[model samples]
Target: MTQKRISKELQECLTTPPAGIKVNLVDEGNIHNWNIVMDGPADSPYVGGKFQLLLVLPTEYPFKPPKINFKTRIYHPNVTFDEHGSMCIGILKSDSWKPSSRIPNVLTAIQQLLLEPVPDDAVEQGAAQKFKEDRKAFDKEARDMTKKYAK
Candidate 1:
């Protein structure tokens, strides 16, 4: 049941991806793991960067929200600056997630996050502080990191 649903969603995503986003399976035989290439939003500091992300759907997908992690590092208040590259987003939260939510919506939300980060609800305190205290520095650092790691 889960595989069928995932395959359907995957096909839809591949055929019609969200703006600045491309999707593919991590492996041909596996339908649960996905590889995503998201183009940085033009208005944001991350522009010109190609970010890679991993999205994993559980066996109980739809009932459970999919998990996404940045394979390419990003400097953002909502994303941890570590090897894990975990992100903090409202839609992906289990309590907020609904089975009716689609993958395209999730990908769009991620793009929105890059365009406008929620510093108050940040996971990375340092980035949040810089974002809140010094906007210029934050943008510069984010752009620098985007060049260094998001290339």
Candidate 2:
């Protein structure tokens, strides 16, 4: 059941992906893992950067939300500043996630996060502090990191 649903969602994403997002299977033989390439929004500090992400679906998927992690490091309040680049986003949270939610919607939400980060719910405290205290500095640091890591 999970496989069938994932295949349907994958096909839909491939056929009409959200703007600035591209999706592909991580391994041709495995449908459970996906590789995502997301272009940073033009209006954000991450503009001109290309971010890579990994999305893994559990066998019990649809009953559970997919796990998404940034393979490309990003300097954002909601994303940890480490090799792991674990992100904190509401839609991916188990409580907020719904089986009805689709991949495109998830990708769109991520894009929106880039455009407008929620500093109060941040995973990276330093980044959050900078974001809240010094907007210009935050944008500069984010752009610098994007150039360094997301290029």
Q: How do the predictions measure up, each by TM-score? A: 0.98, 0.98
Error of 2 at 83 (Å): 1.2
lDDT tens digits, residue span 2-51, model 2: 99999999998888999899999999999989999999999899999999
The local distance difference test score of model 1 is: 0.95
Error of 1 at 71 (Å): 0.7
RMSD of 2: 0.6
Relative to the true structure, candidate 1 has a C-alpha RMSD (angstroms) of 0.6
lDDT of all the models against the reference?
0.95, 0.94
Give the C-alpha miss distance for residue 89 in model 1, angstroms: 0.5
